[model samples]
Target: MQYTMPTIFLASGSPRRLELLKNLDLNVRQKKLPFTEKINRRLSSNKIAEEISYYKAKQAITHIKNDEILLTADTIVCKGNEILVKPRNQNEAFEFLTKLSDTSHSVITGVTMGIPNKLSTFSAETKVYFEPLSKQEIHYYVEKYKPLDKAGAYGIQEWIGWSKIFKIEGSFSNVMGLPTHMIHNYLVNWQKS
Candidate 1:
């Protein structure tokens, strides 16, 4: 089936995801979903992101027009079996950073895309390696960045990532909460369909 390019209604409040999608030059519209996001710990670390993204997309279906696709996404940080969600406070942010110090963790972003009643979901994973973080460094980052709104209590494009993150594998955009490379390809193929 041949399809024309459609406007994408982004049903997320993440500034990073918005900027990432806008940078791609897609016809993007930001829409707010009326729901509080919750992470289900019963899911494995890798599956949690996608599941939440799917839920968000389903919730957004009512707001989407027939010709417009709704996009929703969720990001999660995982260290071993533990999923490190957004920190609740400065102390928790510090603790989360401490746990991530001098170690490798996975940043997984799950993206859902389609019009109402029809959606597809996928996840992108990035392995990020952080250099050992000192207490002072972690404290400074928590106080200055105020990463309470970001998953993993940190943003890869922020100061913490600049100073502490030494290496990464996979999409950098994925670490920021959207996988642009994958999203670009998906949009191209979807438009063709």
Candidate 2:
């Protein structure tokens, strides 16, 4: 019998994260967390994201071997002072999209890397500006895209993003879900140091 060292463990179930990592050509494993608590908007978005990422990473650590690196991330959308999480239903998704239209919001993604006794955590924030959206457009997107599983009720890689996003002020991959460039740089350096 032989054992192969796993490259990395992705502590998330998000298809977007998996896709991003795959795009980077990184060999990784996916580990889903059992419970995700709703983040309190009263806390800073950066803090909330980091805390959640740490929690998820800790939960996944038990399942991974000490030699495998575990990675976890948490993303959230903030408009003004409000933090919009995944919608509870269609109506909430519609409402969230409506508010996001014709406005500027910030998307924050926190990432954690864990290896045995070592853990590193960081966060990336991207400012996204949206053009004014018509009522029909919002409705159509909500019904068509079914953004209930997405934060801010939308995905930057989707139809709305292609047509409505006017500008992005940070890492585009961060907006997608994971900050691949940052992660790649960190991992490369980690391997070297």
lDDT (0 to 1) per candidate: 0.88, 0.87
Global local distance difference test of model 2: 0.87
CA deviation > 4 Å runs, candidate 2: 1-6, 38-42
**Residue pairs clashing, model 2:** none
lDDT of 2 by residue, 1-193 (tens): 7423337788778899999988877778887778566676667889899888888877777878656788898889999888999999999998998899898999999899868668899999999999999989999999999999899999999999999998999999999999899888878778678
Query: What RMSD does each model have against the real structure?
Result: 2.5, 3.4
Model 1, position 118, has a per-residue lDDT of 63
Could you tell me which 10 consecutive residues in candidate 1 have the lowest summed lDDT?
A: 1-10
Q: Which pairs clash in model 1?
A: none
TM-score of model 2 relative to the true fold? 0.93
Model 1: per-residue lDDT, tens digit, 89-187?
A: 999999999999999999999989987656899999999999999999988899988999988899989998888899999999999999999888888
Error of 2 at 154 (Å): 0.3
